[model samples]
Target: MDRRRVIIDTDTAGDDTQALVLAALSDRIEVEGLTIVAGNVEFDHEVENAKYTLGLAGKADEVPVHEGIRSPLQKEYETAEYVHGEGGLGGELFPDTGIESADAHAVDYIVETARENPGEVTLVCIGPLTNVAMACKREPDLDELLDEVWVMGGNVNCLGNVTPAAEYNFWVDPDAANVVLRELSTTIVDWGVTVRDSTFGPDTLGRIEDAAEDSEFAAFYDTITQQVRAFNREEMGEDATTQPDSLVVACLIEPDLIEESGEYHVDVDEREGMTRGYTLVDETGVLDEPANARVVESIDAEGFRRLFLDAVIHGDPERSLA
Candidate 1:
């Protein structure tokens, strides 16, 4: 099979950075480009974070990073600074990429690239869906332009990180989320519950640490993930942490790591207040709507741990230092 052409859209913070590195390291997929959106941090920090991540992995020379939407379509943007830290990368500051973010706007780039390679591009979106929705609105036939989309968002059980009924990515931009959930034909959805349950505990982290021993990438990954682990310890009392976005990339690289919930019609609430952004997953055909997605309901946590550690540890950072 041809190397899967992929464009990763992200709000590069703690785990998103890890996801980016994994994609950069994977030989089976070619990263066509990277598009940034505002989510875990502000738009500017997320873009720079992407560049900094690329620099860390030595993939800066390969991927073209593009700036994306700063705010949601109908709401003011909010960030998870407490979880991701003040500077987005767990407060461990790194030098600027020194490479300028690409001149092409994210929405335009998404449109043009997907159009150029029909049924060959996969957008791995790990953040708010603003850029995608905007691009689709611009081109009415955007669905025909791309092959597949894997978006990491929503919660089927209504247990969410940002709010009781919403995940952060969708909560930030329900209007965009709604559009993507309703209109995008080939979307592969990853829910918060599935990712949250399939987490990396102390054992997995120990493996990653041992494998990444003495490498700068390992230290950075360890430090950046500390905040999340600490928070998880305090909240859940078990240091079971997750890089939810990375799971999307892992599923792409090795599909067996994920199990889907078949085709289900999904809807996102766009109204204001508590319930807004909730992903109404109609599992039993209760909504009586056509299916637009194959919802990922479970992941092989152990399988993912092994695959993620293998991919991330073998990157340039680990080998170059040898």
Candidate 2:
């Protein structure tokens, strides 16, 4: 198999942990590194959560973790402890591995990796786009160097998890989101609507829980995502777990699993108001803007479920390494 090389910039909490499980165990991709940023929690906890997560899957040594910018580029640093729970692991604590994040800063790691790998590296931003934007600032040609930039953000489809007009990730750093969408040509973005479209119902949940009995990683995932499961049921009225970040990773591993809404010129509102962090997509040709990113309006839910479950519960370790 022609394995894809990838880097994930993440907030490292809640559903992001479930998403990390998919990356850690995937048989068709090599997760080169994970850069931790502040969003769902603070810098310290997010980094610890990331390390705990990697260690939980026994991939702690294989995939190095990097520390990224804590605050947004321009906005004040905000946290989501209420949503992700303290410590970003749904208030659960896995015994500390005594491991520390890598010495390199996340922005520099991103820049150096993309410069070294060229088009072979896929950078998936599952949190705010701060690290990627900072990398591009340091290397203006970064957009041309990487393979693809898959982002699990935006809210162009009557959706908003954090605000009336913004997705949580984008709302965290709209400035960075704008920078990446405007500069990177190889981008595939997922909107908040993707979460609603990609959830696995009660039966799959039961299967995953049952599989947890045999796999430590699966059981850990089941325990950590409990808050998310309850939140979704209460807020969205569904007994399902929505892993949009995992959907982005699955699509990166296999683009055919999702249908494209077309290449779009997207703009994010970076002000503070009712429309803050809103993503404005150019659907019609009237905008006359060059398409910098492809939008995923819908996906093959079954295909995503299969890819996620297979990776998390039945994947081969050999394929997950470099």
Candidate 1 least-lDDT 10 residues? 313-322
Quote the positional error of residue 3 for candidate 2 in Å. 1.3
Q: What's the alpha carbon RMSD for model 2?
A: 2.7
Model 2, 1-322: lDDT tens digits are 8888889999988878777877777667788999998788878888888888888777899989999998999998568776677787777866777887799999999999988888889888899888888888999999789987788888875678787788888898899988888778745555654665676789988887999988776687678777777777788887777777878877766777776567877888999888888988888857897877778877777777776777666753333223
Q: What's the lDDT for residue 208 in model 1?
A: 66
TM-score of 1: 0.93
RMSD of each: 3.1, 2.7
- Against the reference, the lDDT scores of all candidates come to 0.80, 0.80
The prediction achieving the highest TM-score against the true structure is 1
lDDT of 1 by residue, 217-258 (tens): 676778788788877888879776687887888777777766
Off by over 4 Å in 1: 316-322
Q: Count the backbone clashes (under 3 Å) in each candidate.
A: 0, 0
What lDDT score goes with residue 310 in model 1? 64
Q: How many backbone clashes does candidate 1 have?
A: 0
Error of 2 at 180 (Å): 1.0
TM-score versus the correct structure, for each prediction = 0.93, 0.93
